[model samples]
Target: MTLIDALIQYGLFMAKTLTLVLAIGLLLIVVLRARPGGSGDDDDDGSRLEVVDLNGRYANMADTIKAATLPPKMVKKAFKAERKAEKARAKAEAADKRRLFVIDFHGDLMASEVGALREVISALLIAATPEDEVLLRLDNAGGAVHEHGLAASQLLRLRSAGIPLTIAVDKVAASGGYLMACVANRLLAAPFAVVGSIGVLAEMPNFHRLLQEKGVDFELHTAGEHKRTLTLFGENTDEGRAKLREQLEETHAQFKAFIAAYRPTLDLSKVATGEYWHGEQALSLGLVDAVQTSDDYLLAARAEADLYKVRYRARKRLLQRLLGADGARALARPLARPIGSVARWLRNLGGARCA
Candidate 1:
C-alpha cells in the first residue's frame, strides 16, 4: 500500500480499537449499575454479606441492581421460604406476641424526607396488625413547621388505622417534633432529649434604615394589606408590629390547643410556657409518658415479635438522581433556602393547615 493509505488505515484501526475499549467500559458500568444489591458473598453456611455503597444522595442504585438481577422465580421461592421460616419462628416464640415496628426520624424535615417518612408510615400501617405495636424512633431538634407537622400527621395514620403508636425520642422532639410525638399512644424519651417548645416565630431584617441613611429610597407594593408583613425595605408601623405579634400569639395558642387536644393528660397550663425539658423532666411535666430509647425497646421486643425497621425506599426519578449527583445548584434551587426560615415557615403553614 502507499504510505498515505497505510497511515490512514492505521488511524482507522486505532479509532476502531478506541471505540471497542469505550464500548467495553460502558458495558461494565451498565453491569455494575444493574447489580443493585451490591457486591457480596453468599457462603455455604447460608450467610450472605451484602455491601450497599450508597453515595447518600440518590436512590440506592446498588440495591436496585441486586434486586433486579435476581430471577422472578427464584425471588418468589426465597420470599416464600422466608415467610415460612418467619411463621415457624413466630410459633416458636409464642410467649413474645408483641411485634415491633421501628419508625426512625433523624434528619431535617425536608420535602424528600417527608415523602420518605410518609411511605414508611404507610408501609407500617399495612404491615402492622392490631396486636403489633408501632414505635417511632424520633430525633429532631425542630424544623419547618409545616414539614414537621406533615411528618407528625403521617404518624397519625397509625392511630387512624387502629394500630398502637409509640414515639421514642432519643435526642429531641421540640416544636414541630413534639407535634408528631404528641399523637403517639405512649411517648418515650431518652434522659436528655429536648422535649418542648410550643410557639411560633417569624423574623425579617429591614434595610430601610441603611438605605435611607445612604440617601436611597425604597418602594414596595402588595395587593393585600397583610400579604407582606415586617418587610425588609418598607417602613415599619406600630399597627404592622401589632398585627404580626397578634398573628404569632394566635399561632402559639393554636399550637398549645393542638397539644392539649392530642395529649389531654398533659398540663397545658404549665408545659405551654415555651420551655423545653429533658426526658425525665418532660415525663414529670407530662410531655412524655416514660423514659426509654428506641434501641433498648427494639432489643427487648426482638425476643417475641418480628422486628422490622421500616423506612421508605427513596425512589428518585432518573433526572433528579443525575442532577443531585452533578452538584447542579439550579436543579435544587426550588428546594434550597435558609434552613431556619424554611423550618419556621413549614411549622407555621402546617399549624395553620391543621387548625
Candidate 2:
C-alpha cells in the first residue's frame, strides 16, 4: 500500500464519520424539541372561512357609479360624493345580503375525509342562516359503512340547522359518497359525473383450505354465536356466510331508508338497483336534481352573490417543514397512532362491495 493512498483513505473516512455524527446530533435535537401532533396555536385557528371572489364586483363598484354633470371643480366634487354614497349603500346592502358558503370534499373508499367535514360544518352552523346556502363539492367512489354513516351524519347537522345545503359532483358520488350527497337538499352534478350504486358489500379472504392442506388446523372461539361472522384464517361455514349476508342486507336497508327519508320522492326500487349512471341519465332517474358543473355554478354564483369558502386549514409542524414529509412520517409513525385516521376520514365514504 502506498503512503499517499493510506493518508487519503484516512481523511475520507474521518469526513464521512463527522458527517454521520452531525446528522445523528441534528436528529436527536429534533426529537427532543418536537411538539405533539395538532398541538399548536395555529392548530386551533387552522380552519377558517375565506371569501372567494371570482368576479371583480367588490373591486369595480367605485368606477360603476353614475356622476352628475357640473362645472370643473363642482363636477369632481359631485363624482367624489356619489362614489362615497355608493360605497356606503353597497356596504349596507352587503350586510343584509344573503350569503353562500362553500366547502369541499374529495373522498376515498374509507370515508377518511369526515373529520375535516365535521370541523367545517361546525363553523358554518354558527355563521349560516336559513337564507344562506352551503355548497359542498364532493368526489368519492365510497368505502366502509359505519365510517361513511358518520360522515353522512355530519352533513345532516347542516340540514337540521335549516341551512340550505347543496352538493356538487364533478366526477363521482357512489355508495357511501352518495350517502353523504343524498343528505343535500339539492344535488348538482356535471353531465359526465358518475352517480348512484346504492348498495352494500363486504368480503374477506380465508386461509382455511391452505391450512388444511398443510395438515394444520385452525380454531376460533367467540362468546356469541354471531360475534365473529367471518374469519380471515379459519374455515368459513355456510352459516357464517348467511349471517354476514344478513348483516349486510340490514345495513343496506338502513342506508336506503335514510336516503328515502331525506329524498322522499325518489323511486327506491328503480334507483337503488346498485347501478351507476352518468349525471344526464341520473337527472331523469331522480338521482340528481341538475346536470351542471361546479365550475359554472360557482362562476354564476360569484357574479350574483358573495362566494365564501369555509375550511379548516391546518398548518404543518415546524419539524415536519424542516425535515420534510418522509422524515416527519418516519418519526411520527410510532409516536402518533391513529396516524392515518385523518387520511381515512378525508377519503370519500363509498358503499361497501362484496366479493
Instruction: Go through the candidates in order and give the C-alpha RMSD of each one to the true structure.
Output: 15.8, 9.0
How badly does each model clash, as a count of residue pairs? 15, 19
| lDDT (10s digit) by residue, model 1, range 21-59 | 667655644643442354533223222222221122122
Superposed on all Cα atoms, model 2 deviates from the true structure by an RMSD in Å of 9.0
Q: Which candidate is the best by TM-score?
A: 2
Candidate 1, position 57, lDDT: 12
TM-score of 2: 0.73
**Candidate 1 regions with alpha-carbon error over 4 angstroms:** 1-89, 93-98, 109-112, 316-355
lDDT of 2 by residue, 1-355 (tens): 7999999999999999978866765675576456567353445543454555534443454334522334667657766786697678668777666778878898875666788788888888887789899999999887777778888899999989999999999999998889889999989999999999899887555678998899998888899889877787787789988888888888888889999998898999998878899988999999899999987887777644667777775555566678887997787665344535644433422224411
Best by lDDT: 2
Cα misplacement distance, residue 141 of candidate 2 (Å): 1.0
Candidate 1 at 191: error in angstroms? 0.8
Please give each candidate's TM-score: 0.66, 0.73
Give me the displacement of residue 221 in model 2, in angstroms. 1.2
Q: What is the lDDT of residue 134 in candidate 1?
A: 81
